[model samples]
Target chain A: MPEVLKIKNLHQTFEQGTVNENRVLRGIDLNLEAGDFVTIIGSNGAGKSTLLNSIAGTLPIQEGQIILKGTDITKLPVTKRAKNISRVFQDPKMGTAVRLTVEENLALAMKRGQHRRFRPGVKSQDRKFFKKQLAQLNLNLENRLETEIGLLSGGQRQAITLLMATLQRPDLILLDEHTAALDPQTSITVMQLTEKLISEQHLTAFMVTHNMEDAIRYGNRLIMLHQGRVEIDLAGEDKQNLTVPKLMELFQKHVGSGLEDDTILLA
Target chain B: MAIGVYLTFRILDLADMTAEGSFPLGGAVATMCIIKGINPILATIAAFIGGLIAGLVTGILNTKLRIPSLLAGIITMTGLYSITSRVMQNAANVSLLGKKTVFTIAQNWGLSRNNAVIAMGLIIALLVIMLLVVFFKTEIGLAMRATGDNPQMSAANGIKTQGMKILGYMISNGCIALSGGLLAQNNGFADLNSGVGTLVIGLASIIIAEVLIRNLSIGGRLLTLVVGAIIYRLILALVFQMNVEPSDAKLASALVLVVCLTLPNFHLPRNLKGGKQNARSTKD
Candidate 1:
């Protein structure tokens, strides 16, 4: 299997050389193979979002090289990287343009990396395809094609954001705690939808979550980040059979310290 | 004219003072062009291009140089006063008493001067509105709208947000300048103080349109701008009929806007159109 993404010697530091200097990511290296869905688990103040931001090119790369499909994208701007990488932010509102209609948002996503021309937006022929895609979500959003996204509920918005993220079938999908803002029921629905979309599209994805159950239940692989480093990594049959207690034992065994707070992880 | 302000203020979310400078700049440029024997049609275009340049300056100052948008517009507007004077050969007014304009050309086509001016304004406004409607529906136009709607989302979606903003400003100011040119020609001269209170008029037109037509489609919204302008003019005429002093007209327009904005929120007499009955029925 070929590697779809590679991060070499990644490092991120905030307020460098100052009294409040905080080193978030320290000499981390990660690689994701094709069709890999990796769930990252970490405690608060951990560099989960920082790593995702670094990958998405929102944060400047102070010291690292990010290669996506053999291309050096370390210096590419956020929008340029968006051609190959689509992101669903933790906040549902951050993922979409609230003022635009659903069809208009999808129209934007459809032309992700393509050079935008003076052609009519949401072409007549493209409407059928958009309608089909929206219908597949089973949210009855097909009829609300012209509705502004701001009018949608939070859960509905998150679901649409997920759909928009995958509209262009990006090389990598970054979900930065995408469902963290939703209610339990809505979160489960969105999670199930996330799983369905990933498997159906056979996509490579990086999902950062605070919920250990989610980190363990989904994804073929799980990574634990502790103090700006990869503390433990599990995959395959091991990840399949993993539970809360077993994962805590593994964390204790690997890090040589008892798990400090299981509640944060459990929740 | 109001559409330019509508673009920057309502759409782009930028309160640009560039219109104050560019409006008169258009008049200065067009009057000078006509004085120099240029064709009337081409002179109006020159005025539009002049406004485009003014808008571009403000856009660059705000985007490239990191000046705040409001200050950048003020800087450009302050500088334009001198530029407009220079364009008018340092004269306070550039009269077109013996000069031929688009209005004059229309008169030569066998229309009365009054009819010619009215026809020219109507035709040009209609044509510009139609073109804008088409332009806003295009992909580039969508991107521009998206840029204004949310810069962060736009950048994330691979749009060069700064460039879109600059382009939006250029289009906005260009239209404003064209209106300025028409105003100068129709009124028979370009006065140095012609741009005064222009921003207020533009804002009033936009507010009136939005109040009159709520939640309209994009095309309908654009059309409402023209209607709003007409309505605003009518209100001004009424104010004049009420024996209001000419100089106090700005104060009167501002008060009209205040009333229109607040009226929708006020609870009026219930028996009018059975407002109470509808409220009770809907509650059920």
Candidate 2:
């Protein structure tokens, strides 16, 4: 399988040459194959979000080369790169415009990265397509096309946001702890839906999570970051039988230090 | 004109002071064009283009130079004051005394001058409202709406938010200038002080209509804005007829705006109405 994403010599340092300089991602390198669903686990400040932001073009690349498929996108602005890259933010409210109706939000998502013309928003023909897409979520959002996204619950918003991110089948989808704001029950439901959607579309995805069980349970591959570097990258059979305790033992064995409970509590 | 204010203030979420300068700028430009023997319709369009240029400068200052939006508008508004005078050959006012304005042309068709002005204003306002209604429903229009509603989300979804904001200001001030052009022709004079309370008038119209029509389609809201402006002008006329001082008109307009703005935040007595939670529980 062709490499869908390549991160070469990635280095993100905050407030460089200042007294408060913090080295976030220190010369990190990564490669993702097509249809890879990789779940990443890390401590609070382990540079997970920073890494995602760099790839998503939300942050300027201080020193790195981010090659997506065959094109170098390290210098692309967030809006320009959004054609091939879609993202679900940690905040449910960050995913969709609150004042817009459900169908309008979907319509905006439909033209992601495409040249937007002066055509009517949410056309009659597109409405039927949107309804069909909403129905697949089984959230009964098809009936609420005209409802403002703000009036929906957090779980509903996240589900709709997930749908928006995948509406056009982006080359890569980044979920930045997308369900972290929801209750445990809703989180599980959203996660299940996410798994269903990713598999259904054969999408390449990078999911950052604080939950160890989720890190192990969903994706085919798993990665654990410690101090701005990948400490463990497990896949296939090695990941299938993994448990939280076994993962911690492996972390301790590799990093030559006792795993801190504070980091695990974040899980 | 209030619809233009609504686009900037409500839709784009920018409190642009450029309207004050651009309003008079429109009249000044139109007066200049009339002096050059240009057609009135073409002169009005010239004024609109002038306003669009003024808005473009303000947008660049805010977006490219990183100035605060309010300050950017203020700077542009202040600069346009001198520019408007320059456009009128260094005079504080310009007279279009015997020129053929849209109203004058209409009056030649066997209608009273007063009726002609009213008819022209209504027709022009309705045309603008119809165009805006259609424009706001377009794909690019949805992107602009999203930019105002949540700029971060807009950028995330590949919408050029800063560009959208600039376009919003351009359209906004263009409408204000067009209104100024009409006012100049209607009154047969474009005075520097003609735009003194124009922003207040626009706000008054928008707030009054929003209060009256709480939930409406985008098209309906645009229509209500025009109706609200007409009603507001009639009220001002009535106040003048009651022998009130003309100098107090500005104060009266300001007070009307204040009351309308604060009305929505008024809380009813707890027992006066069935609360939402209580009603839901009762239904259950």
Question: For residues B60-92, what per-residue lDDT tens digits would candidate 1 score against the true structure?
Answer: 999999999999999999999999999999999
The TM-score values for the models, in the order shown, are 0.92, 0.93
- In candidate 1 the C-alpha lDDT for residue A4 amounts to 95
- Interface quality of candidate 1 as DockQ: 0.42
The alpha-carbon RMSD values of the candidates against the true structure, listed in the order shown, are: 4.8, 4.3
True contacts kept of each: 0.63, 0.76
Candidate 2 per-residue lDDT, tens place, B160-215, comes to 98898998999999999999988898888888877788888998898778666655
Q: Which stretches of candidate 1 lie over 4 Å from their true place?
A: A252-261, B108-112, B267-284
Question: In candidate 2, residue A198 scores what lDDT?
Answer: 97
